[model samples]
Target: MSAAPELRRNSLDLPEAVEAARAQYAARRPRSAALHAGALEVLAGGNTRTVIAYEPFPAAMVRGEDCRLWDLDDHAYLDLCGEYTAGLFGHSEPRIHDALHAVLRRGINFASVGPGEEKLARLICGRFPSIERVRFTNSGTEANLMALTAARAFTGRAKIMAFRGGYHGGVLTFPITGASLATLPLPFVMADYNDNDSAAAVARANAADLAVILVEPMQGSGGCIPARPDFLATLRALADETGAVLIFDEVMTSRHSAGGVQARLGITPDMTTLGKYIAGGMSFGAFGGRADIMALFGGKLPHAGTFNNNVLSMAAGGVAMGEIFTAEVAEALYQRGEALRARLNAVGAAAGVPLSFTGIGSMLTAQFRIPAPDRPYVPTPGEEQLRELFFFDMLEAGIYLARRGMVALSLPVADADLDRFVAAVADFAENRAELLRADGVTG
Candidate 1:
């Protein structure tokens, strides 16, 4: 409208463009700015969740309905974040709301066991093929912790083979370049994802003491990198040969289908960990597998949590699994997600830019790297700057996605909203292709 502000790497500078975007963002959300300032006086860095903490502070959302959200500044946005895949039913899924409300009427904590837990357990066992005997947790992080603990106890071994780019939970993260400092103090043998040889070598080296081979069918926090089917098969074989348990962390990827990516690939692991959308947006997590392994929890291995099977989570999870997320619904959602990702990638390709979206079924990450990362965490030089700029641009366009360029589609997001997101990407490509390709070489 006003000649596009004329910012460039060799001229005005890419940082100049970012500054301009930040200025616009700040101007539009004065109220949110004050709120953040106030939060800074209390919360560390003005945030509770690390992922949501970004530069210039994140928006405080006030309300949401269906696939839309209203920020504190009263700016309406199409919610593309979907609460990091935990909000699959969207802001106001009547079914989930009703279930929670009904649970409240039945009563709060009985200080013992409840009937809803059994219903939820049955639904989870029925849907997920690898889960024969399941146990609940307050979060996916807990689920993975217990799963790994079980493996160690069952095998009488301590070593675990975890992928470099894999993330089981907050305390169990393995980054591509190096390991996270917050990672649990456990004997971890890290291998590269999507590399059979790397995994094989590690598994063999730790064979004697290897307790489990933990992986994600599709890496979520690791930029949505999908593992090659053969790589998974190799892990399965290696686990069997080494007498190690194979655990699939489907906390996020379980949204791929009713039975998760495991069912789609026809490869069953010894154990499975699940969370995110499983409880219909309520806080929930579960870990289960061979009866012999889970049976330990009931006997020797003690699994204790104040709200492991809370009424709200149990009821909501049961309704979500049994009614809302039926097999047919899963199949349809999967198809829509596949089609949406294809269209988004096509827009990037057509723009002749290096940007691409990588993921499976309703989950995706917009990245600047091409050919999609196979293993090593070494990122493309200018990949991050491009995505940071894209994040600001999309936010300005009223599309609420993760600052890290994550997009998790909800069931309520309409086809028209999809078109709008694609259009926004197209505009970003056209407007920033030169700066993106120049790799920010400043004058």
Candidate 2:
């Protein structure tokens, strides 16, 4: 199906819009500004995650519940960022909170496996057909590291291939340098996302040394782009041809479905790395795949971590996956996401804006394009300019859009909230032409 119809472009004034956004934000978040100034003395840029850092100051979060968050400055927002897509059940969910209390009271950690670990593991394997056995880690990054290590051990190969835009999170350890980042280790060979020929060429060239091919079913950090059906099938074929293990890093995309993008796409990886929503807004991660490959860690390879299956994380995750997140809930998210996409496209069409929106299940992104009548190309920086403009303007309109073009939809984001989000996008579409003009990107 096509996106909504197009709209006419509005004349914009660049400098004025930038100044307006700056002044408006500075006034609304005075507490954050003051805190940022004080924090600069001790912490670099007064924040933690680089992604959260923005122009002026970062909005420090004070508290969160369900889908709403209150920033340090006492400003409340409908949290679309969702802790960078980690708080899947929304923040401080009741099911997980209650489970945590019970688990913590019983004990925090034991050197041996907890029964809750098996329950969570079973939940994961039951959802995804490929994962015969699973192992827990503390984060997605660690889970990926484990997957890569296990893949190499099983195949007896040294090199690994990953996609250019795909992120598997341990480039430094594998010496897999990211195309977008300057970090090192630098051993990974890159393939383009959604391109079958490009992936085939990489597989052919590295056929001998390649131990694994790690990919994200949908590239989250690269921009919420889904892998084409042909691309996934091609990779799986290549893995079979080259005798390389195929791994899907489903950290961000796991919330989209019970089995994640792999199942939704109807492709299975040999191994999978999962995190984010698994712990119900807490820190946790796990990786699993074919039983033969995953069992290497127990006696064949030997890997250990102090908190691999920490009792509390296991307990909370078991409850979240077992009871809180249901097939009905996931389907609800997909429906809501579809509505949001349609609304955004409609506004873009009415405004003559090249509003191209695409997403699978619950994840979505809308990119603005220049004034081409049909099939308009995304603006030179793709949609970055519009993303920045919308980010600032939406905040003024009282919406908390992440600096990125994405908004993670939580279960609590109801009809009213969706209305507000759609209205904000329309406001941006009407005003962005002017905002860009003011910023000096004139025709």
Candidate 3:
């Protein structure tokens, strides 16, 4: 009858511990601090990418080799962030590195259809189940934009259905805080993720005006939460009934399998947008689907980008898909990730830490939350403090995690490294027991 300890609204009283960690972090990275100070003169808030920035200044990584990174302060860390899931092949993948060199020797930008484009396109079309025909783009943001455009053109509808906490790209974010002003100016009906009835109701309400229902098979930026099979099935059925385009934004989840999450889930969307490691760690993006819808792009609605088919991305992407990340290797990597996640969860259970990791395959995000038997998972208030404390603690232990507590595995990460990371988490739970326990976190 009493309030659940984990659900009580108590202030996270860890200022002293947090300050100590911050002090240690600052003392270890004076050079990085100075770099950020100087960068403030030019770059906005000493940051070009918003996600990489953190308080007490972000560590300036000097170089990376395989699964390791060294900061300007000479601190070495196992690169668990994996460039936020984009560094799947790791920093120094030999094949992709050599392929980029070959591309440079041949030409930087031919400004015309290059030989590698077809090769890369062929590989993508073959690997992704939904991509019957594909087109290149400079980034995933552009790819999503193009896919939505194609949908609106084909369906002649102006509205889009997106989920709260879903991040398609910089301009396509739909956080629980609400869509930002920078988000593309379109009529977007927001729905809760993994809530089938909410999604179905939203789709029904907008069935007449819905152009596309855009979703991530696993919501990457929304804490790596995988969609329930029934939820995806509901969307598929809704799209079928309404004749709206269903687009899966697999920019991060595509690395889950050779055929991506769509193939694994036994669901095929009308379109798929891809990026991240598909280009072998190079900058790249792609969108493709039923040939009938895509045919409208060049003929009915003009689509062009100067670097759409750049030689470097095309060549590296081709080698990445065809030579390195074959179906067999992808399956093996996925199995490794599944095992690692299980181990991590086991460690959390043993330590009595209220830690939950949500993800599939090589992608994951750690969250601090109270378990609810009758409701969906919702993060606890002041959980960010726990996350930041964990981040600094993990860094001190020589594991580089995202500030937001995301950890992604790369092909080059060894089993020993994963074991070490798990050990580090256990150590964190022990060391921060008082603070965590006071916050009502329990196994």
Task: Name the candidate, 1 or 2, with the larger TM-score value.
Answer: 1
Full candidate order by lDDT, most accurate first? 1, 3, 2
Model 2 Cα shift for residue 328 (angstroms): 2.4
Instruction: Give the number of the best model, judged by lDDT.
Output: 1
Alpha-carbon shift of residue 20 in model 2 (angstroms)? 2.7
* Candidate 2: tens digits of C-alpha lDDT, residues 127-237: 876799998899998899888899999999988887765566644222123344433454578776777888899999999988999888877765567777788889999
TM-score of every candidate: 0.96, 0.90, 0.95
Q: How many residue pairs in model 3 have overlapping backbones?
A: 1
Write model 1 residue lDDT over 188-285, tens digit each, in one string: 99888898889999999989999999999988888888888999999999999999999999999898888998998999999999999989999999
The global C-alpha lDDT for each of the candidates, from Candidate 1 onward, is: 0.87, 0.75, 0.85
For model 3, what is the C-alpha lDDT against the true structure?
A: 0.85
Tens digit of lDDT per residue, candidate 3, span 158-255? 98999988899999998777658779888899888888889889999988999999999888877888888888999999899888999999999998
